[model samples]
Target: MQTETLTLNGQPFYIRRWGDPALPPVLLLHGFPEYGGAWEPLARHLADRFHCIAPDQRGYGRSWAPEGVQNYAMSALVADMAALISHTGAPLTVIGHDWGAGVAYGLAMFRPELVARLIIANGVHPVPFQRALAAGGAQAEASQYINFLRRPDSHKILAANDFEKLLALFSAKMDLSWLSGELRAAYKAEWARDERLNTMIHWYRASPLQVPEPGQALTGLPDFPRDKLLVRCPHLLIWGQDDTALLPEATEGLEHYAPDLTRVTLPGVDHWLLHQTPAEVARRIKDWMP
Candidate 1:
């Protein structure tokens, strides 16, 4: 409901906040091409119960975006989040979607003490996701865009023609009813910020996670260390059955990593479920929150 700035890791980061400061905190992390405002709808829905804090994670919106792929590595990304969590006063619930989900998993895995609960929507867990990608199946096919995003000139392509490609990437095949002209403009503005486009794409380029080449075998790819990546907290995964980017197959076998996992699949919704049905998403998170 309100915007503020906090310096994390010695860099200024922007955040959107809602609800009473005295209430329990719930951190909302947005995915690529979106800023903290992406959580506005859901934040408003739960404002009465929880203090929703959505930060423009390092490389997007008004946040500081340091150059280079290495700067966007999981370690740096997680460190930025760890600093934010410490700044925000942790032991709070974390809600993330897409890339944000990856960060949430890392937080729960590497810094379990900071997270009371982890909730992800259409996000991947390392084990199952890598398996799906390495298996050279539908999930792998759907993830080809990750490779494209890793390209050096991806920003130009995404920014050309007024972010036409970016718009499609965000809303293609899913409902756009919620993405009004004003909302779309706001998103475009965020994407157009200084060094944000490449910085956002750097998140994909800096990762060790690789989407296997189409039809490629899993024989040579480095195996994920399952033991080290396990999330030792109550985890909830919400899936939109129609999400093509991160198929249902990605969620398979997640329980192996998250022993206390709750999975909820929503029919007819796609990757844009949060934007399409914010209230429903909020309700699901609220109902599941302990």
Candidate 2:
């Protein structure tokens, strides 16, 4: 992979590229607590057929992570990616996992001209997600961690003892076989960087999505501009059925937004499937977009 820094909106955004620039581009967006390097496992499998470009998104890895909760707003996050897409040339396929999928859906909705296709793994769109989270059911209970991360002092706790708490948050009793050895050390190194723990968690604070106390509904969410939230491009949702954090109900009725949508479920896999079964994910992507 090749690395470079681009001055995006006056921020030094770092990017990793695999495969030839002349080939069709595929933008890979990673989620919170993980960097662009997180895409390496899957990118390696897709590089021969596609140009995989993964950037250390706003408050993660080597990207420009500014101070304050306002800086982490969804609009700002989407703008950062929009600039990258415009810089890289439009109509490229976008693949996102976790938080990355949020930005990918934003791009597909607001800037459809730039996205050839939309793909999400272990992620959900804001509308349905907001619905599920507000209803105060299983998904809301599963998402209590978001509220914890939003705490101003949560970073201090996570940073202690070589990020013991952060590791616990990451694992959450799921399969972490892919997180051991070299990759584990690499993630720790990124976490150890100055202000990373603090800035990365601010994303939780900036989001308007509400997670009520377990078993109680959170009402009166602000109006969502539903007309603009449609995903016009061909969309593919790859899910790990065993995912505990984001339950199926979170993305229930996703077809209403993404008219041309296809879904593939992987049994016994969880949120970290990108790392756990990247080659399988790669094969599915190739088969879809080939």
Candidate 3:
């Protein structure tokens, strides 16, 4: 893998690329509190067929972390993605997980021209997500992390004491023994490389900044074209059936947004399916990509 840093929309962003540049490109977006390295295994597997580019989105890992929460809003996140795709100069297949999945949906919703296809793991489309949150039972249960993230001092607490707790959060649901000591150590080292807690938390903080008004579902939200709202490109959705943080119900009604969606639910898997079932995930992706 080759690593480099480039300024996108005035913020310095870090990226890691694998495979031949001549091949078609696929951008992998990592979730909260994790870096691009999380996708290294999958990237290596796909390198022979696809040029895989993984970037530390905005605030996590080696990417730029601007002060204040507003800088991390969805608009800014999508802008960074556009700049990165332009910089890469490749027809892109975008894949995102968790928070990164949210950004991927935004890109498909607002900038369809940039994405050839999308593969989302463990996150619902924004429209269904907003509706689920408003429905108020299972949605609230699955989204408890949002409330935790909204706390003002949450970042300080997570980052305190040399980030012991933050490291724990990264490996919370996974069987650490399944991971090599080197990989585990690398995850801890990345969290320790910079004060990422604040920037990571900003993802949640800035959410309400652009949230729809009360009683307004994401389908009615401005900036997302309703008539042309369906994901124009092909889509593959990989969901972990046992994900506690994002319940399967969160995926309800997704077909309304992705008319050409393909789905696979892995039993006995958690939110960290990428880590727990990397090979399986890679196989599905390889088959899904045209």
- Candidates' TM-scores? 0.97, 0.98, 0.89
Error of 1 at 252 (Å): 1.1
Candidate 1 colliding pairs: none
Mind sharing the TM-score for model 2?
Answer: 0.98
1-290: candidate 2 lDDT, tens digit per residue: 99999988889999999999999999999997899999999999999999999999988888898999999988898899889989999989999999999999999998899999999999999999989988999999999999999888999999899888888887885887788888899998887777887888888899988889888998888767667999999999999988989999989979999989999998888999998899999999888895
lDDT of 3 at 188: 61
Q: Between prediction 2 and prediction 3, which has the larger lDDT?
A: 2
lDDT-better candidate, 1 vs 2 = 2
Q: lDDT per prediction?
A: 0.87, 0.91, 0.80
lDDT of 1 by residue, 214-247 (tens): 8984767665677798898999988888887888
lDDT of 3 by residue, 1-290 (tens): 99999989888899999999899999999887678988987887889999999999988888888888878888899899999998887358999999999888888878888988999988778766766666566666546657766788987777777666655555565444555577767766776666677787889988852233334334444454555667878999999887876777678888878988999988877888888788898899998877
TM-score of model number 3: 0.89
Residue runs of model 3 more than 4 Å from their true location after superposition: 167-180, 209-225
| Highest-lDDT candidate | 2
Candidate ranking under lDDT, highest first, comes to: 2, 1, 3
- Segments in model 2 whose C-alpha atoms lie over 4 Å from true places: none
